[model samples]
Target: MSIKKPLDPGQEAVSLCQHHPREELCYSCSDCDGSLACPECVTSTHQGHTLVKLKNTPDFVWKKLIEHYIQKAEKFEIPKILKELKFAEGKLEQNRKHYQELIGVVQQRGEELKEAIDRITMRHVNTITEVAKENTVYIEYYQGELHSLHTEIIYALRKCHQANDTEDFSVVLDSEKIIRAGLKLPRVPITQTTKYRMGPSPLPLLESAFGGVEIVGYRPKQLGPTVPHVVQKKLEKPEPPKPALYSVVSEFRHLTDITSLVPTEDVYSWISNEEKKEVVLLDRAGDVKQTTGLSLHIRDICTSPITNNLWCCSEYDYSVREMTTPTNTEVRLNFPFVPRALALTHNEDVVVGTFRKVCVYNMEGEEQFMASADKLGRQIVASPQHISVCPTSGNVAVVDWDEQSHDGNGSPCVTVLTSDLQLLFQYRGPQTRALRSGKSRASSTRKNKKEPPPSFWPTDACYDAAGQLFIAERTSKSVQMVSNDGTFMRNLYTDQEFSPKTVGVQTGGFLWIGFDFGIVKVIKYKQ
Candidate 1:
């Protein structure tokens, strides 16, 4: 006669539904409480119900179930169970051997007592000693076998999980096949040798013997931490709200050409790059308060909102200088490349934009971090012409000019980065029709093909008190306002009177726009 093997769930070929066994179940009905459905069923019975496709679920329940069992065996259950079993088996073997030795000693003592005591008492002692050892050999044999089987089971369990985890189907199949065949515990039949009988004690001097049998209970030791330590506390002083800046305050027009501007609490400092004599500091009324003269040829300047210390970079010396006062000037750090632009971070670090990359340096001139390339290993800044840091978010904004872009016109784009130099996004501005310059289309095509004009050639950028970025393009006279996330908000200015070059935000939220012809506008651009 032929025999059949039972079906295994692991090897079972799953079907669509119990009723429509041929069709595959691809989706589950959401409204009908997870009822299995095929495409045909979706149109029929489950037409109105929202359907969730099986393919959409990244992790299947079967995979999770297998993982759970494996974790239980490896991390918690198997090791603990095996340890306990081994401990119990050791105690059982030790007790059994100890009892046999004790029986031999007691039997020798009983033989001596048999000579001294009456014949009846001697006979009873012999019967009792024999009864105590009748099941010792059989019980010990069973225990040893049980321990061996437990060890095998533990090994098998570990191997099965390891095979399952490694996705070794053949190993797992072989293991489960052996397991299902059943490795039962060895059956031990106890043979009755002697009956339970009262006996004269071998150790007659001691009334109660056999280690004074006692049931000792165990209480598990507590593993929780006894000492409570507080790690975090709520901030006592919350940050104050940022003031709104709306509309232009006043247009501060100057006679000298202004290259860069930095706003302090009481005054605004404008650097005339054309002149090497001094940096002019003016009050709100456009009155010159002081003119700080230094040895460096200032390319850009920035003042801290917290501290009114003036920081300026020189193109000729390739160094950044910090000026606490007009007379007190110190060369902070010297760089190989010229520092084109500068921004002061909240922690008083100076973010210097060099030829190739943007670098953040502390007050002691120690380099903290840099943004030379993006997360995907793509170079972010080609020529970091201008840079700005958001006071609130600490996000670094840079206007990089691509020197090799578009037949030498230089394609410029703004890059927004986190304080840690992670590239959040790069804004290239709106995709508009390119405005061609230089040669005629036909003539350029005949000689060298003409390319589109650079869309955003931003010369400088500054962040307002509310963390809004203002980009000043070289091509346009207007200053474009952008959100901290690089979203273009609106044009802050579009006037023929001034051609905006570099921009700065004053302490009281005034937008300071410096023009090529020494025209500086101190306008409020936010509400």
Candidate 2:
């Protein structure tokens, strides 16, 4: 709880030397061995050696050092210490509350178990009482029969005794003979009730009743030490001053009518003309390795993140099929709308962008959700040309091109939607200087006729691991790299004959772009 008072800046900067009374210790000689040498010593033996004036040095350095200490105290050091103390106190309070709550829960559970046990004991007791009553009835009936038999015997004995007392020898003898003939123990049987006691406790009975209390816990994770400035600067990647440019490294010719391009672990797979009914997987050398045939006309194809199979969308049948092997095809889903663009998400879900809506489906082809309208009930997608999922954010991005709008002056734009079909960001790429300067659309078009168009009509889109989007502009024959949030990052590729239509990022930093002339270009953009 103690705090050190700060030093005053107005204090004297230079102090006087203890040995020299007249001069201050403002200057020192480098040659003087471990002793504070005055100006006289500097002029005597250490004239040639290096000498520095302590007072001549900037006072700001000392001031800055003091300020840095204060800054750390006020900003980092003191605050961090206080935070640790507060956190410790909070943990103690939380532990106390948790202990009380746990006890309450245990007591409540015990009471419930006790009630159940009492009910079970009472049921047994009731059964025992009823059985005892039934036994008593049976015993009473047998006792009554025995009593009647005893009465019959007693009456006979009394008659015989009276005959003997009256001196009637003949009658007494007759009675005795009759009594002897009839004399027999009562034949009524008596029944005994068996005793019972409550049995021993079952071994697992307590465990089953209470479920054995368990304490599960979690504590906030402690953060690692703050990175030093020198180390952090090295660790952090410097943002490109201007976006980096991509150059063509290689090209594959002869694949005609290429529509979709996808790259895998060791090869690049692409779909060309539907009439061929085949998807070609090419090695790094652009040599055909495997050709998988499909029955339907494939519009787009992406590598499934789950099965690592080739997932193809047929625009003709509006069907989604998974090409498990080279010859095996599993029809997963048939959609009402024609699926145009397809992208496999990190979670292995298939994201399809159709004519008017963006739909998400699992690998089984079950429709999960759709983003057809915006928050204002306005149609969000018009003609979705391409779809890509941001790996970092899991956001589904769709490029919609409406050719019929504004008399075909429609500028294609990108729409980013959440996994749950909620809108995140929609942008029409970067604004042009002509548009920003309040120029008319016609004038701007005329002015930019000779130059590359300010914005591109999105033909295809794909995202890299760094969350950068590579969009193919068919008109300009170029591919632009954009940020996940729709900021224009850089032009990835522009070519005269290629006319990039669809693009894909490969294992390394190589880009596979399919062009209008059935050419596939593999370009390296990053190390």
Candidate 3:
């Protein structure tokens, strides 16, 4: 679009070159647009006009315009066509490589499939052929005997009529008698016995004769169940001396899901003496077997440090109870809300957390204090299992899990609260966000909504041997441990699997897992 050209003729100031020297230089009009009229008489009137004194016809300007058109054609059209042609060539090469590689894999797989088909077809064909051959041999032998008997019958009958005396006395046997005898006759001269193994064929063929001829045959009889007879041999098993103290003398099946694991001083003694330790377990259906009123769920269970007895929380019964060895009894108690987690502090106070509050009780189930609830709103009431009575703080740390997601309902959190229901500190991890903001929370509880609950559900929090706090997350298939400060520890998975419906730490420094079934295991760490 630009009009300027590269060539510059600085000034046309000189009076048009008047001399026609060398027969090339000529005078032109002061203005270059048209021919000059007789050299314009050399006047100053056309001084500012551009003048041309060319030495040749149609000089540089016309040549420059032709050059610009040639460049535009080469740049715009030729290079684009070349790029497209190269791209097509590369695409074809790539396709060839792809088809070659695919051909080998397909051919190899097809061959294997063909061989499998052949093997299966041949097995069936061979079996059918074998059975047909056997039947043909049997028919030929029987038919020959029947034909011979018929021929002999005719000759004997003729001889009897022509005998004229008792010379040929005995009667001739007909084909019918021969056939009957063939079936009944035993081995007069010993013959090999033949047994046919059954194979695929029409049922009618099994009874019909070869060559489609009719023959006499008998139906087989039915038999009873077969048994093998053998001589008897006996061996004795020696009995080991039973340690009356540690042996499991009784077993209860399907009685209850084991809810707590309690280890004994006797088991600890065995551990110190370089022997395997045995753990005792306690489980409950959660009451005095009452059928009415509030239905109690066995939320949590623990062993009393002072009495070595089992204690469990029951929502229906609203009670905490101590059970004597392998047996439980009802103890009247009241909890602030439905108890979900239970903790026994060093001072022996029973700490339990439920909807929006933590309640403290004595060994006898008497209320000590109704701890904090302000920080926990309707949004966060009860955690699955995260009520830990901190020995260091004497304050309870309750981990709520709903708010961390910034969800209307699912603010997942762990709040440190005082003994008198006062809010102190709060901790939260990443929470699954609410699918719809400014919506009701109850909708989030639906199973298929958005985020599924993690496999790791909180179970209990306690101190390790070093007094460092730790936590347990349990499931039907796994049990994992994490530091009480919410630090992740190594996950435990392998060999033995336990439902770990609940967990407890033994006074003997072992970890106990409670199964949903009526079984329990104690994992003792060497370290």
Candidate 4:
């Protein structure tokens, strides 16, 4: 065959249509799965078929393939898979933490058991050693007695032999003394071997002492892609209307300002007057049930929910005292810093607010935790005036009055924190009324129209059964209700006549608002 010439650089090699050998393939038939066709074949064999130029067929095929893959990828459920992967990672992390905690518990218990076993082993060893020492002494005494008897018998026999050989009465008489000694040999000392027997193993008891692990099995019903069910939304029940302060049930007037108020489980309350340097228990009928005088000025007072014991702190003595009612017996707990505010948690632990720190103590006055700075190393409070612990959540809420604030505002704020002292949120006050009116503080100052809004000065705060905080706002002359999350809900009661200095909530929906003028009003609340 003649050698085919190499194609030029600028020219492309062409294939001839099978149907028409002379004609070059000029197009591709889409309906025929991209079969090659020439002009003659296109008109005859591939008539009425979708055709693409052979030059453009490769790009068209590539685009169609890409589109097909795009649809497939969209239906692959990749997002759901990624979410499941993240959930699994989180679960693994939780498992790690839980296992670590369990391991620590097991190790601690094991150490305790080891100590107990060591003590028991030492005790048993000592007992056996003492018994062995006594047995050794007895064995030595018995050996000496046997040696003495053998010597006596040998002496007596020697004396008798001399008497027989010499036929002398003197030798025989001497042998009699020896024989008497041999005959009088101490009765064979009764000896008993001391044997030690191992007691039953304590392995089973120890296993129960430390506790056993529980194995729980979890089975997933379906592993992979499943059709999600269409769940109908359930109607939520409407919340009951919040109770309003209908009327004053009873009002008690004091000669001195009431610095703190604590309602008790009984139909009485404990009120402290710093000026009077005393705390009094008042009945529902505004009668003084009992009065307790303090040597030092009382800064704040609270009552234990469990024991109903009165607890008060003194800034003068730098101490917290628990007073058992009726007997008036006092138990003093000393602290490094002066305690200004006092509260008792639902668990009967003491919560003390000092200059700039909050401390927790058990009933015996052992400090469990002290919180002065936050995780960021920033001081949490400048001056804590009052403290309250949420009965439900155990959150500590403090009325922080910053007299020496960096900004020199000297405004009081309410700071809420977890039991571990993690900062939650701080409430300065609600949005200024001017701000609600679309007026800025800068605008007001520039126009000289009105003074900026007054700063919030909270005197005290307490939580109700619903976990809502009732704050005594000295500047606003109102008892404000705040949600547990620190949002200002509404003013529970506002009085232009008196400034509330302290607020307390009692069982059966009663609000005890202590005013600056030494007036305590018992208002019945609906909620």
By lDDT, the best candidate is 4
Model 1 per-residue lDDT tens digits across residues 1-527: 11223378566344555445567777867576455687778788888888878778557744654576688779888899999999999999999998899788877766765555677667888777776677777788889999988887787788888877987756656467558877887898576765442222245344333234344697544323442333112322457896543566666667678777767665565555635646888765677877877775787788765567887888888888878777777888888878888888877888998765889988777889987755555566767767788877788888777554322124567777789776777666644322222211111232243556665667788876566778887666778887666667677777675567887776665777778777777777653
TM-score (C-alpha) between model 1 and the true structure: 0.48
Name the runs in model 3 displaced over 4 angstroms. 1-256, 262-298, 324-332, 362-381, 384-408, 411-449, 474-478, 492-499, 515-519
lDDT of 3: 0.47
Judged by lDDT relative to the true structure, which candidate is superior, 2 or 3?
A: 2
| Model 4 per-residue lDDT at 359 | 87
lDDT of each residue in 38-148, candidate 3, tens digit only: 243334534556655444437565465356557765986688889988998999999899778877766766677668658967987777677667766766667677677
The TM-score of candidate 4 is: 0.50
TM-score on alpha carbons, each prediction: 0.48, 0.49, 0.36, 0.50
Residue-level lDDT tens digits of model 4 in 340-400: 8888887788888877788888877898888777655566666888999887788899888
Ranking by lDDT: 4, 2, 1, 3
Assess candidate 1 and give its lDDT. Answer: 0.70
Pairs clashing within candidate 1 = 245-526, 245-527, 246-526, 246-527, 247-524, 248-524, 249-523, 249-524
Distance from true position, residue 328, model 2, in Å?
A: 1.3
Candidate 2 lDDT tens digits, 396-487? 77877744342223556667787777777665654532121112222223322343344657777777766677888866677887765667
C-alpha lDDT of all candidate models, in order? 0.70, 0.70, 0.47, 0.76
